[model samples]
Target chain A: MMEQPNRGRANIVGNGSVGGGAYTSVRIVGEGEVLGALGCDTFTCTGNCTVFGPVRAGLFKQRGDVTVKGEWSGGHLKTLGQLTIEGSVRAAKLDIVGQLTAREFVETDNLKLQGAIEVNGLVNADQADIRLYGPSRVNEIGGGRIHVRLSRLTAMKEWLKPRHSTELSAALIEGDDIHLEHTRADIVRGNRIHIGAGCVIGRVEYSQSLHVARSAKIGEEVQL
Target chain B: MEQELISKKDLLEQMDISYGQLYRWKRKRLIPEEWFIRKSTFTGQETFFPKPLIIARIGHILQFKDDLSLDELAGTLSPLQTDIRIGAEELRMRGLVSEQMILRHAGLALDSGQLPFDQAFYLYVAEHMSQLLRGEITEQETGALVRLLRGQLPKLEGKLCELVALRTESGSSMVLHTGGGRLYADERTTIAASIHLDEAIEAFKKKLYAY
Candidate 1:
């Protein structure tokens, strides 16, 4: 167990190791855990790591598996592993390449996800571009520009899954420009709306234009 | 002329309002629930709004944001009217509707002096009698206008209605309708002027009280 501030670069390796302190750069090489709040400039974790408290960093990159039990905020966050956030996450830019499970909201200026994301709360971003690789669920999404699509792998996986339906479920999705595919939402509202293939929507209200794909199912479409 | 609609994105960008601000206003009921129109585009589901109405509303909210809270603004924006009183002299002074027009429509003689009008009576004149002052319709048309509004007043209660005036080659007429009921002036009347009855009344009051 190490409990001290590392001014420069701090690297932890091997199993059964715990590092807790503020550092300029933190690199967790193996199965390392953080017991206290950790603040760093550049935080990279290659092996599985569990952060017990909040984390604030300039740049956070996770390559293996990481779990944060408290709120997390950083300038830029890039995750390519199984990341579980128990609390909200605030970041300027978030790039996710693997699976993300967040209990609360995810607020970011720009979000680009090429994998799966599940959230109990809303995802509020200035701009969000998500390509789902598997079944993903979110309560609500609001932003300026939101584009969600299902990747080929996701479609294949859904076909192979035992469940009959694999569409992403969301209560509401609202934004300026919104395009969704393989999504099931109660209501979708925006300036320009496009419901692509494999979407089941309850109601849609738009001001300018509305285009619905033949494969999509919509209950009602109203132009204001 | 058909009004142009504005895309939600364009409206926010043009007004410099964030998504958070728009949703906050919506949650506060400052913006009517029906105004959030949903449509589908090439991209996905999007929201749209009536361009002029939303612009005016946003402008009013921003202009008075410092003077009033969001709740207060919503109150002012709402069509509900509890107590609205206007003196006949004030109405005449403001030139909302001419004395002769009121005398002819309401049958109030000038010699009887000025009297305060309730919200319904004031709204009736603001909606129908204003056209009389503008010389858009004849004195004979006032009878029909009065009967229509008088009949609808009780049904309206404190709710709002839209007064629509239509002008055709034959003549001009007025109509008032809430969501439930509709009253038309004449069969040949074509709609030329349309406005919210409460808004017309409020505008008249503002003009009268400005000085």
Candidate 2:
């Protein structure tokens, strides 16, 4: 398909609102609200932004807080603070340093998470690299390679402050190669599965190989 | 009517396929999302699939994975993605649809250029149902069925549904409804033939990809 000429740019300097439409780039510096569906090449939010409709962008960068009432589809998304998406998220690459709450599914080609995530639906990614800094929860995780571990910073900060929970809780986790630390799951299935330290898994199903840390607890193991 | 469902655990055991393969196929759209039925079981919530449908789909995937890439397999398995366009001549040459059947039912000439997937799908469904019914339905009724499907299938917007040919003393008519529901006819009317739209589409895809 031929690319259409961009509809221009929309920028919010302070507390402002803009009706959503196709744009070349959207830059929100302060509190901003998009009233309808947004389609843009680049969306950069510095403070806070609330989108009442779906978002389609090529590059989405958020520094503060953003809530999308509808689905969000983008190519490269990097968030430094918090993100709340009521609908599903479909992206090529997602990099988050803070918290993310998605009511629906979150699907990406590559996912890099450093903070926490709460997803009511499945989190499907081709390559998921998660370092939980806080308690995280997901219904199911399925993909090619899934690796979840407690963040190094979170581990080091635990000695300074009282211990804080930094783990991932999932009902089902399935992939080709999976290595999880500080994760609690009902079922873990993969070709090569490694249950790292502080993991409490109900069952482990591996086809090729399996390894469980001495500190990890597993209810059952089956070689498929 | 309720479909028989196989739990995910049981399906894995029965199919001898790993969870990774199943999830990967699902991600690739080889398996439709609607087929994944989640319900609360004794062991919390679990996923289930329509037994016969999932079995057949897994068999098809296993048969083709050796020869076709997952993306190509997805193109054939996914009915929602209908980017395939072919000329009537090619359709005849591939024998996916007989030229006589196309000419008689679709009323399209051999020289009619490239046919979009929707038109081709309508033609395929029409020919399939007519052939199945054979002498049970009249030629006029068959033509009416084809016309009804061609008009209404597009309106359904790719919903998983069924086509039912109904016959009564007065006349014969066709109805399309979402599948998995029992369509009852009064004593006077008889349900002549019923076909699942998804199954038909899968068969059509197989035929199209066979070449």
Candidate 3:
């Protein structure tokens, strides 16, 4: 038997196409170029999804894994299966029971991704446990427990480059209590790390737990 | 050139100000889009005043809310004063001593950076937050505005976020189990990450004690 969603609450705003029921519905858009949308007051889909327009669901639920091949901009994107999104996915909380794979972008307020996340482009999250194979911009992690194996952690302030630091091949943050660990980059800032290990840090600020494995080499002083 | 200053009361009258909104603004010192238009009586032609000046003053007023006087607001308003300082103690109190702390909290912090909500809400949230976190709540694992209402601070009962509200763990020193997932930690320098709870016991902390 199909599940029935709470009625009396239905909203379909903007331009898009929608389908499914309140408990077991599916509202999706295909092409990213399309300007319309598929909306439902309460959406429930057990099969597929391809939404390009804005989605507003009072209560949107799905059973099977949903593939967001295009960009998704809406209130919430909650799915039970692995969500493979190519374009940007913006929502309050993009909760996916399965793995979330974004080839291009994924931005959200609070993301609870059960499976591993692979980002080829930019992945910005307030609190996320992501596996980034490409570049990423993370604001603040709510649960400050991350597992990233990257080469370098470029300070955002420096990355913004005043359009003047052209000579600066890379940006290195210098200060006290800084740490750099397990990275491939060439610079180090405040308290460094012990994550991936064996990285060439440009400089050391204040690393209380700065560990240099036998495979790592330092060509500079340990202090300012 | 002649500059026009108007009375706040008159400006409110002109703007058709409601009692609740005005009271909320005055108490919180949060000026929204209309901004704090310096109103002085000069004959009777109404003016919107200089847009840029008012906007600039809006920035100063926000910073100066600590002091009731407009003069103090302008004098103490410094962009440099806008930095968030999570002391080492506070950082660990929230159980953020892990690698994922920054990644997870960055979103919450950025979302706050995006709260184009009226200044009043911001002040009410900030002030109450300072109070609740600094002194009220016992644990730092999670926080909620409702908890503030129960304490000395008034309640800010609003759905700040749909599934989540602004959260911080900068006060509790207990070992937290994020309920799911294991985070990488480096004992030396881990910063606490704030979570956006869903009307949960978050978003409040007592204003830090006056130094």
Count of clashing residue pairs in every prediction: 26, 0, 84
TM-score of each: 0.53, 0.68, 0.32
Q: Give every prediction's interface RMSD.
A: 5.1, 2.6, 18.3
What is candidate 1's CA lDDT for residue B90?
Answer: 55
Ten consecutive residues with minimal summed lDDT in candidate 1 chain A?
A: A1-10
Ranking by DockQ: 2, 1, 3
Which lDDT tens digits does candidate 2 get at residues B1-211?
A: 2456898878887998866678768767788787788898754577888785678789888988999999889867555444435567656776566676677776652234666566677767767676777756666776787788777776675588898888898877889888568998999998988889988878775665441
Please, what are the lDDT tens digits per residue for candidate 1 over residues B8-99?
77887799876656865764567765666777886565668867557767887888888998778877665532222344655666656666
Every candidate's lDDT: 0.74, 0.83, 0.38
lDDT of 1 at A24: 84
DockQ of 3: 0.02
Task: Give per-residue lDDT, candidate 1, residue A207.
Answer: 66
Which digits, one per residue and each the tens of the lDDT, describe model 2 over residues A17-108?
Answer: 99878888999999999999999899999999999999999999999999999999879999999999999998889999999999999988
Candidate 1 wrongly placed segments (more than 4 Å): A1-8, A156-165, B1-211
In model 3 chain A, the worst 10-residue window by lDDT is: A162-171
